[model samples]
Target: MTASGDGEPRPFLVAASLSGAADADWARAAAPHVDAAVLGGVALDPVSRAAARDLVARGRSEFLPDDPICWIDRGFAALADAPVRPGVNVRSATLEPVREAAAVCADRDAVCEVNAHCRQPELRAVGCGESLLREPDRLADYVAAAAETGATTSVKVRAEVPGVDLVAVADAVAEAGAEWFHVDAMDSERVVAEVTGDTAQPRADLTVIANNGVRGRRTLAEYAAHGADAVSVGRPTERPAELARVAEAVRAWREGELPAGEPPDRSEASP
Candidate 1:
């Protein structure tokens, strides 16, 4: 139910993106409950791979293997028959790997998501992840490189970063040809509205997906009220019941069964 009978995007969607755990098998298992699934968050290139290894040494979650291009190809190959829209969330310090990965995504008609949401010290120290938030021009360059490959490009960002203006970052990436803007709203769900509701220069073509603390009907309603085009589940993505609940809530909201003013509830929010 990710799209209409004519193959257009659905009114609302349940998306899931796993850091180190996402693979073809995970995507297949979760595909039944989600409309779209982003895989990997894989580290591409020498610098990013080195950063991933450091994170691994520190017991942080990250996808491994030195050959990330082959990994992206193989992962997408295994998901050729999957029902959900497949995407790869990637980390790279330079444009070469991003172009390489986005080329692979273009070949498969998949999404190439730039990782600007990771806040780990190791990732930031290497100019990957959240470090891009502080350098919007660099982040936009990554998005532009990905877009140049003819793949659907997305940028995953976070709010409440000390000196970063999330809306300006959104505009920069959007101007660089990003089709999707995935916002990890953290504790500021209203930021979704701000990004989507930018009246100065509306980004009508950018699809804004709200993440963090999204669980069931309550959170879903809250995000929708804040103008999020869709919602994504992160840490709780492996829980089938939780995915099912969120999917059901999406369906309810689409069908007008979920109230717009449903009280905010963070009891079941994911980390």
Candidate 2:
């Protein structure tokens, strides 16, 4: 989805995982409903493995296809389980090990997002992913490097940053040829209430994707109503059947229909 300078409609990202084999299936099921997809993995690929071996100091964790690398195999395994073709909410971003990993996505015309939002400390000590969010210049540099690959580069980042305004940081990343702005919003009742009426400026600009604590149709609709372009979730819709239900709910929200009430009582769909 293209965004005008003043902000545009929200977009979607089928946030899935490398470890959760269900993500691929969920992605396939959710794809038709959303705008794009991001295959979230918590580890490093082989090349990243070598990079970590070289660059990381002692005790640094290797951020691979997943933070644990075990996630990579799981993610690929999930891809194997998909019945319908994978689709998603907004733009798609997959974990890459080297330029070649990016090339694979580019060759297939698949969108790959850089995982800069994960906050696991193992990744932080090594100076990758979420840790880099604090360094916009580094984040920008990473985006620039990813951009050079001829593959569309987008970043998944958290809402709060220590040094930069989350919104401003998102704006800067978007300005640097980054196509999608993935925002992981926590489930705060008061915050949730304000989202729908919070539209000001650039907030609407670009594709603003809301993530984090979305549980069921009601919560999904709440964010959509509040101006979310699309929403990427994990627990509530990780299976095909569940994804279908969630997708229908998302469609309902988009069309002006609201789910009966607030979202279901799901305290587990945490970040």
Which candidate should be chosen as best, given lDDT against the real structure?
1
Across 92-167, the per-residue lDDT of candidate 1 in tens digits comes to 9898889999999999888899999989888899999999999999999999999999998889998999999998
Candidate 2 local lDDT, 35-64, one digit each (tens):
444454434444434444543465543333
User: Cα deviation in Å at residue 213, candidate 2?
Assistant: 2.2
Q: TM-score of each candidate?
A: 0.94, 0.65
Lowest-sum lDDT 10-residue window in model 2 = 85-94
Candidate 1 clashes between residue pairs 3 or more apart in a chain or in different chains: none
lDDT per model, in order? 0.84, 0.51
Model 1 spans > 4 angstroms off: 1-8, 199-202
Against the correct fold, how does model 1 do in TM-score? 0.94
